[model samples]
Target: MKTIKSNFNAQGLVRIDSDDLKLEIKFESSQIYLNVISVNPRNLKTFFNLSDLRKLVIDVADKLAFWKFDLTVTWEGDELAYLGQHANPNILQKFIVAKNVEIKNLKGFAKLLGGRST
Candidate 1:
């Protein structure tokens, strides 16, 4: 996991890039916006299977916990375009909530919760 850039203070943005993923998060007055691109063996264009997608969301929710703020996630690249075709906003909220609960249950997790700027 490598941080490309980060500004995690109020109304900030963070970008992290790794071999398998590229994640960008922006904090605003009313919400937190997340943009994710999954790079995997199957597809270079950010294709995500169900398992991968779930894991991505869980990891994100765990690392960045801001329950008070509304969350918005944009799945980037061509493979995830299907989600937009069948969009249901509630699904994302439920998934995030569920993942947040899972994270809370595991003690001593997210040692580097809010990432440092580079």
Candidate 2:
């Protein structure tokens, strides 16, 4: 397993990579946590809102029978944060792109999760 970590400011963006799947989350407002998931990495389009992302993840967990985990998203002041403890890359990618939004920078965008600049 691989790990990625970075600090995010208000409305800041942070991404994580596990195998072929990528996770992109943007800090929308300090009042609430917001994230936009995408498949193929480059689209950076948001298909699932917080509730949507949770439901989809639950459905996938039930279908795949992978280890059950909880995802907590929070934003306080100038901080945007996310915690996803999962093991299914396929499900993750699927959930991210489930809504079918167009990605802007395929290669460039996914890279942002690990080491690309916004």
Candidate 3:
């Protein structure tokens, strides 16, 4: 797995992008929900909001530790049944690291995550 970029925005939005997927998390005030999910497979674009956004990420990272796992994410190449969210980070626009997952890098950005950076 590879680490692309992890960033935090002014409005308190934290975005994490891997070769296979780009996830934007909005777990701050006003919108206490994880609304955006983009995976490697173009077909999975319509399959966002799978579960707890944080848990989903943590799961994906956890799966990376295993070389041979049954569930493979499109970004994974995707995996995350989502056990649950973190127990902390209840503050506004605060991003706490629950777990870190290393995503394998793809050849190109547009083809990897199916979206190119602007």
Candidate 4:
């Protein structure tokens, strides 16, 4: 894994590139935005397999465990294919689970967290 760039000031950002994936983590106010993209050449014609997708999510979740910020994951390209045509909430739930971290409904924290998109 390689960190392409990082800034931890207010409204910070971090970009990591590894294998065929890119993780862009941005901190804005009370929330954290995690954008995961597949950089594999083959992804142009195919979606990420379940194993790779799961690993990506778990890896990101683990890395962000130290932050108390609410997280919003934006799916793109082949990643969206894995999420299905409608962005299945159930599958998304599985991906966002981190060891010892509580995943809560965005509705409950929307006001306090500044209404970040889920």
Candidate with maximal TM-score: 1
Please, what are the lDDT tens digits per residue for candidate 1 over residues 18-96? 8866888787864666677543433532465556755776555544543233455555322221111122334554565
lDDT of 4 by residue, 12-107 (tens): 899989886688978786467667654554542256554575566566555554333346655452222112112234555655543523344445
lDDT of each: 0.46, 0.39, 0.39, 0.49
Please list the Cα RMSD from the true structure of every candidate, rounded to 1 decimal place: 13.8, 14.5, 15.6, 12.3
**Candidate 2 lDDT:** 0.39
> Under the 3 Å rule for N, CA and C atoms, how many clashes does model 2 have?
4
Question: lDDT score of model 3?
Answer: 0.39
Candidate 1 clashes between residue pairs 3 or more apart in a chain or in different chains: none
Across 1-118, the per-residue lDDT of candidate 3 in tens digits comes to 9855433222366677777557665443322223235555665556644345446666654443332222222333232222122222233313443333322222332344345635
TM, every model: 0.38, 0.22, 0.25, 0.36
Candidate 2, residue 33: the lDDT equals 33
User: Which candidate comes out best when scored by lDDT?
Assistant: 4
Clashing pairs in 3: 1-103, 1-104, 2-103, 61-101, 72-78, 73-78, 74-77, 74-78
Among all windows of ten consecutive residues in candidate 1, which has the lowest summed lDDT? 104-113
Summed backbone clashes in each candidate are 0, 4, 8, 0
